[model samples]
Target: MPKNVLILHASPRLNGNSQTLAETFAAGAEAAGHWVSRISLAQAQISPCQACGYCRGHQHRCRLEDDMDKIYPAILGADCVALAAPLYFYDWPAQLKLAIDRLYAFGPEYSIRDKETVLLMTAADQNPQSFGGAEATYQLALVDYLRWRDRGRILVGGLNEAGAIEGHPALIDAYKLGYTI
Candidate 1:
């Protein structure tokens, strides 16, 4: 079945390595006949969650008025959601974190339950432990609590320079992963 995949690209840099991987994954998904859409956080005006309990009411909608309004619909419509970002200080970029926090609006409605979640992460270090933080977040928030299916993960490391991720084996792996979806 062709799936609607929503990829959230959270690299602050234009054409950053993580963003490139996201493009590659999207291309592969599209080639496989799946519909893919990408939201670049660098260009979006999303705000962090205020931790207010407004969404907990019967509305099931976020009260904060921001660019996240554009994202919520895509998130709800997607059969698969991929979060792509470079590791900054052992975690994803703050922009992505903010959007993620805002997903609290969906909790009241369980809108994201049963969705397939994929993680696309890049880091400057080659150490495997560098990805622990994002993985922990995925496991705790998406997998354990939200009950989203764990689709797959592509973690590319030791890439700092712009476009350094090109020609890397992981890029092909990412494409293949998406194709299989």
Candidate 2:
């Protein structure tokens, strides 16, 4: 069965290591006959969510009109979501977090309760603990809030320069993860 996979690339740099990993994963997924949509948050005009309680009051929809509206439907339509980014100051880029926050408008019914989620990240530090904080954030915010099944996580560390993840062992893992999905 072909599954719809949403890849959210949160790096501001176009050719960042994280984006490279994301592209590899997307390619593997496509080779396996899955549909993949990669969205670059840096290039998109996504606004932050203002907690007006409007979505909660009005049937799980946001009042603010922006790029987020377009993403809402895509998320609802996706069978799986891959959050890809380079670790920044111990967490995801601000834009990615913004997207995740805005997704709260989808409400419980439209939430990713049964959907699978994969977290892919690259870091300059070689230590595994470098990504712990960011991973914990996803585990708490996305996994717990949306109640999604965790497919797996791929973290490539010690890649400071752009596109460094291309030759990393984690790239192989990411490819396998995508193809298996």
Candidate 3:
């Protein structure tokens, strides 16, 4: 019953608080004997979607061949997908958004629906409302678009400095979520 999990870290900073939370979640998932793979979008050369509509016509395959080409297969094969990023201007970083948009390739035609997904995020502000937009996007774009069952979400606020999530309660919660997966 080990699920295949993919964690997409969208933080530009390698050790950013969000990335730390992602690592914590991954650790928990691994402890639970789930297969996990973590990919850092900040370090990867993922191209933005070109609205070419080629993928829509061509079997859910993106036309522009790049790192996205590499990621597409993983997305299809995953039993669970986790999107991790820091809140930026009440939304995810552009890199993450672009990568997400590109996933449009797997539109309704492909039937990549009913998978499981989790979202993990960190922000400088502690306001619970600060992450609404980003959370909404994940719900609509990833969960609804792919018809994935929502597993859960971990939103950590008031963490700005890099690695600030270390030893935080949210980190512990993330670990538990992963382990429970």
Model 1 lDDT per residue over 101-163, tens place: 888888765767979989999999999899999899988988888888988999989998998
For candidate 3, lDDT tens digit of each residue in 22-133? 8889999999999999888888888888989998878888889788977888887889989899998999998788888887788756466857999999999989999999
Q: How many backbone clashes does candidate 3 have?
A: 1
The lDDT leader among the candidates is 1
Runs in model 2 with CA error above 4 Å?
108-110
What's model 1's TM-score? 0.96
lDDT of 1 at 54: 88
Put the candidates in TM-score order, highest first.
1, 3, 2
> What's the TM-score of every candidate structure?
0.96, 0.95, 0.95
Cα lDDT tens digits for candidate 2, 1-181? 9999999889998988988898888888999999999888877788888988899889888989888877888888899999999899988889899899897787756555778999999999999999999999989977887788798899989999886776788888888999998
Candidate 2 is scored at a TM of 0.95
List CA RMSD, all candidates. Answer: 1.1, 1.2, 1.2
> What local lDDT score does residue 112 receive in model 2, on the 0 to 100 scale?
54
lDDT of model 1, residue 99? 90
Ten contiguous residues with the weakest lDDT in model 3:
106-115
